[model samples]
Target: MLSKRLVSCLDVRDGKLAKSVRFVDTKDIGDPIEKARTYYEEGLDELVFYDITASSEGRDILIDVVERVASQIFIPFSVGGGIRSVEDATRLRLAGAEKVNVNTAAVQNPDLITACADAIGSQSTVLSMDVRRAEPCDAVPSGFEIVIHGGRTPMQLDAIEWAKRGEALGAGELVVNSIDADGTKEGYDVELTRRIAEAVGIPVIASGGAGRPEHLYEVLTEGRADAALVASMLHYGEYTVGELKQYLDARGVKMRMRF
Candidate 1:
């Protein structure tokens, strides 16, 4: 079996690393470049940087900041927010991002996914979905609705359906973020993650609600996720990437351990 990956997320707002609870009450924490370097040195398998306000602000992503952060990290770097076209994705790749993630713009124009995949291989195209629990209905039969603009707008799109569509559109991977569990640090929404994992053939990264090492184990195994994206637990100095990987590796979850 392929080793499960542990990814660290750096949510930036106005060029500062920030954190939020339930997609609200955001507060700047520290410098993103410093954090990126720390995590990379501590054995993080991948890093994801998101410009939380870029989409809503109607501007391009902070490329300067992305370049600065990229210069500090050696792991696979995936960037998102305000990427509207193939040109934007190419620019991010040129800025040192191995993958370009699209959320709001992809939902607005799914063809953008195909376009980016064509420009920079599908393996470099990541489809990020910010989802929330909703009443099961014909519109969202999976009971999960995709939200955009940093979870401020509901798209009424079914999470499972969108995952399949994203794969069909040539997205090489999927990041399923549960807004309901985001920043909670309690545990991942295993059911929601498993449902989407089973629905899509591409890799599924479970984002949000990672508190302890056991949570990562559950999400990686029971949740059937290819990777687990962490924020609060690692951002606050609660756990280091190496420590988390050690705990997971000892529990039979294969990890890329750097000794």
Candidate 2:
């Protein structure tokens, strides 16, 4: 088994680090560069800088802000939002991102994955799936459905099946986020993550609902995830990557402490 990883997420909007609950009601938390510097200094494994609304609003991710954050952080950075073509991936990489994450565009054209993989190598492409549960029933649906545009528009496709399709389409890694669980800090949607991990051969990154250090350990140990993506909990000064890594190492989760 791979040692679990702890990644810090930076969701930026209007040039500042921001976070929202269920992808709505966003509030700027702090200057993005400053926040990113804090996490980088705290020894985060990797950093994900999401231009939260770029895809939905139809514009390129803010490279100026990206450049600002990338200038200060030394960890591998994954930048997403409004990346629709292989060219888009190339430009972001040249802008100092290690990987490009695509969601809405890939769902619209699954071939984008193959194109992107061919252009930049699959390792440089991270397929970020935005998912949400369907209406309540007797039991939770065995499959989650893709929710795009920050979970506002629902895609009529099974999330689990889409994950398998993404793997076949040449995505090197996957980050599965629960719209229902994002920023709630209750914990990750572990069951949802487990199913996706079981469905794909690549690493699965569990995102959203991470509130405490234990939540990190639980998702890796119980949910069987390869890595975790955390935002609000870390953004709000609730805990640092170093703090979580130390806690996990002490608890036998086997993550290397960065600092």
Candidate 3:
């Protein structure tokens, strides 16, 4: 079996690291470059930087911040938020990001997915979905709806269906973020993660609501996720990436113990 990955996410707003609950009440945490270097040194497998307000503010991603963070971290780094076109993806790549994460823009124009995959390899294109739980209906049979614009707008699209469609559009990976579970620190929405993972052939990264190492293990195994995206736990100094990796490794979840 392939080793499971532990990815630390830095939600950047105005070049400062921030954290939010259910996509609201966001507070500045620290400098993005400092936090990025800290996680990378703590044995994090991957790093994801999201400009939280970029989409809602109608602006481009902070390329200067991306470049600085990229220079500090040697691990695979992915950037997202406000990425609108192939040109934007190219800019991020030139700024030193290994992959470009497309969220709101991809939902608005899915062809952007294929365009990025064509320009860069599919492996360098990541599809990020902000999803929330809703009542089961004809449109959202799975009861999970896709939300966009930093969770301000809700789309009629179903989360599971969107995941499959994203894969067909050449998104090499999927980041299934549960808005309902984000920053809750209770645990991941394993059911939500599993549903999307089962519906798509591409690797799914289970994001949101990770409180402990056990939560990581559950999402990676029971949720059938290839990786787990952690924010609150790591951002607040609740746990270090090295500690989580050791805990998961001891419990039989294969991890890259590079440290």
Candidate 4:
């Protein structure tokens, strides 16, 4: 079995690392490049930097931060936020990101997915869906609904359906973030993650509500996720990536045992 990955996410607003609950009350955590370097040097498997407010604030991702973080960290990095077109994706890739994450723009124009895949290959394209589970809205049941604009504007799209669509459009991976669970650190929405993982064939990275190592193990082993993405836990010195890895390894959860 492939080892489960430990990915550290940095929600960047104005080039500063930040964290929030349900995408609200966001406060600066630290510097982006410095934070990214800290995680990479600490043996994180992957790093994701999100320009959290770009979509809602109506601006492009902070390229300066992306450029600096990319130059400082050796680990594979993925970036998202205000990424509108293939050109934008290309710019991020050129700026040192191994992959580009798309959210609102993809929902607005899914054809952009095809355009991106044609240019950057599917493996380098990541589709991040910010989901909030609402009971029986419109044509869907009590499942996940996609939210854009940093989880402010609700898109009338079903998260599971979008996952299928993303896979069809040649997306290589999915980041299923639970807005309800974001920053709660209670635990991952394993049930939601399980449903999405079952519905799609690509690797799914379970995000939001990861408080402890067991949460990561549960998400991978029980939720059937291929990986877990965490932010607040690592940012606040709650746990280190290596510490989580060791915990998982001890539990027999597949993990990268070597740096």
Per-residue error at 148 for model 3, in Å? 0.9
Q: What is the lDDT for 204 in model 1?
A: 96
What pairs collide in candidate 2? 144-159
Q: What is the lDDT of residue 251 in candidate 3?
A: 92
Candidates 1 and 2 compared by lDDT, better number: 1
Q: Which clashing pairs does model 3 show?
A: none
lDDT of 4 by residue, 1-259 (tens): 6778899888888778888888889899788788778778778888898886644332344777777877788878999877899998998898888999998899889988888888988998999899988876764564688888878888878898899999999898999999898888899999989999999999999999999888998998999998899888889998887898889899988888877
lDDT of 3 by residue, 6-45 (tens): 9988888877888888889989988878878888888888
TM accuracy, model 2: 0.92
Q: All candidates' TM-scores?
A: 0.95, 0.92, 0.95, 0.94
Better of 2 and 4 by lDDT: 4
Error of 1 at 52 (Å): 1.8
- Candidate 2 structure quality by residue, lDDT tens digits, 85-115: 8887888887788888989999999999999
Model 3 regions lying over 4 Å from their true place? 55-61
lDDT of 4: 0.86
lDDT assessment of candidate 3: 0.90
